[model samples]
Target chain A: MSDTADLTFLQTLRRVLHQERQIESGTVIYNLPVPFGFRSS
Target chain B: MQFALTEDQTAVRDMARGFADEKIAPHALKWDEDKHLPLDVIREAAALGIGGIYIKDDVGGSGMSRFDAALIFEALATGCPAVSSFISIHNMAAWMIDGFGSLQQRRKWLPQLCTMEKVASYCLTEPGAGSDAAALRTRAVRDGDHYVVNGQKQFISGGGVSDIYVTMVRTGAEGAGGISALVIDGKTPGVSFGANERKMGWNAQPTRAVIFENARVPVAHRLGDEGIGFKIAMAGLDGGRLNIAACSLGGAQAALDKSLAYMKVRKAFGKRLDEFQALQFKVADMATELEAARTFLWRAAASLDAKSPDASMLCAMAKRFATDVGFEVANDALQLHGGYGYLSEYGIEKIVRDLRVHQILEGTNEIMRVIISRKLIEGAR
Candidate 1:
């Protein structure tokens, strides 16, 4: 591939890379494991 | 605070897990027994864009974040920590070049490194200096247009087989500020590699001493300014520690998964092994510890991505906690397997052996404690 195409591809990857969610001040919710024998029937 | 992974992150993790399961898991034992590097398998991973997972795509990388890299590495390590750790080392090398090297140097090396066509090795630890890296004795004296480098780097993965070595050499005086990073071609004259050192684990990758005897390297190959090599190496270690910790997490998790499967089937004097209270407690503890380690690792990785003030401390804490817990979890899994875990065919023994080194390399767990205590004391004042 040409250098320009390579540049474009990398640029796209950079954009995608930095696109991850950034948590600010809300409560960080974790889906903790359910306790043993505590499952609702 | 969002603990859930985004679709892209989850997709990356799944892709890595699938690749590790299919391409690496089956051959792990054979490769370990043969002491083979499996270059082809590693290159296949490169095809998945892992070679430059965090490097910019312009430089032929995936340009992912450190958190993404950590998740992917944990998934990959479910196959084999030895192979995954080697890939982590290579990624560290790639990141160093891209982060510290000039635009010209990045253009020259990043593409090949990102593709794994030219495997890279980081040369930092010397015979006498492992944790105390700044006191290295490798010398690189300035010549007309080149520097005559003469030194030895110990315990370097991909030592002999790699195409490039990102070497740390003493250029100025006697401290961290006097060091320099050089990108030396592996085939350079007088640049020889010692035979691979036989070790207890990590057999799928080669580790050797990189010896330089009056090797002349061009000045243009140096990364960053003079006397900044220590800084560059330390920066790489922050990420390196996380990746190694992630490897341990993956291996321990795999062992736990295997133990869970085995316990459900293999029975003792009772109905089933999992029916026993003691074994269930062990299972519960292992799962909980592994999850805690994973959570801390993710937080540390994200801190590194954000370049937070406590990033280094977080990395050290994560490495220390995760590796120790990982080893404990793997050991418990082995005990749960009874005698079968000790055998090679079961693969639990291999995981235990491989996880053993994570506590030692990339700065020992003891050194991690030192870093953490120092940070804590300073923060208190």
Candidate 2:
């Protein structure tokens, strides 16, 4: 629930952020819906 | 071929690292424990001249390149990623205003922001928007000479503390084409800050929602051309992601450095822990992956500096790789520390907690994967 979007982008937006892996099949606009509201403190 | 830090940049990074260690690092535990950082340390940082990295001197800034700014980010995040986030966001917002704001807007805002007289926030991700920013539902309807903004923005870092918000709204039509960037004055009527939401990490800088119920922003507050808000926001965030990745690299650097020092001195089972091959391999992997990530981050920044078509793809890649690497490194450091890593005095647990957010914000690592894979397919085609 906590975010650093205001003072910093240091906290990567949960939706768009991730560890990227090269796709064997080329494509654009990958739909990876984020699991928001998960608190990991 | 070029990865070495410039002389001045090295000096700046060193100074910031020194400041963080001497000032922010020792105090980071207490601040994270209570989730409050002193303003005086930030004020002191402002005086150091690296405060306005990548902004021009004529605009009351240090005029350092994005590369130099990345170095500063990495260095400062070493001591405390939370406090570093606060300072870096100020600079990032300053960069956008300087780059895209009108002369009047710049003259009105940059001096105060650059000099740290006023803190700033970049507001783009709404509750419904997130990665699908083109679908952002925040509305800014024109009424008379001013625009009345309505809707809520979640995950705003300097929400309550910032004097201004670089707000993105739907001004023209629909989709990405309709988005317009506006500089909403913090004290504007109908502009109100939500209570600081207690976050898992980066508590030093408050993150909250901003609600605008017909918040009237002046016509003069618009940045760049009409309906170019999404463009401006995207441009700013490309660099924003790079800087965030730098913060990851920086924090990971600190975590690795600390863990290595800890492993050597701590004796277990009648032997130094560094002699343990399993632990050594983990450290080795951490160091190697971090180096790869750092290389990737700088390469991405350089590509942006060169305005490469690949810059966009590289930004996501660097952000995704560095952040994941950061999380891995932090978690491994904690494991290496065993039970002590979970304790606050060691500060490893806090670093672990802080790094957990890296994979989540500034475009979640999931979205980064999406962006990169999309680019991969398109380029191949």
Give the Cα lDDT of each candidate. Answer: 0.89, 0.79
Give the total clashing residue pairs for model 1.
3
RMSD of each: 6.5, 12.6
Recovered share of real interface contacts in candidate 2:
0.00
Best by the lDDT measure: 1
**Residue-wise lDDT of candidate 2 within B87-131, one digit each (tens)?**
877777778889898777888888677667788898988888898
Candidate 2 local distance difference test against the native: 0.79
Deviation (Å) of B287 in candidate 1 = 0.5
State how far residue B43 of model 1 sits from its true place (Å). 0.8
Question: Candidate 2, residue B21: CA error in Å?
Answer: 1.3
Best DockQ among the predictions, by candidate number: 1
Q: Estimated TM-score per prediction?
A: 0.92, 0.88
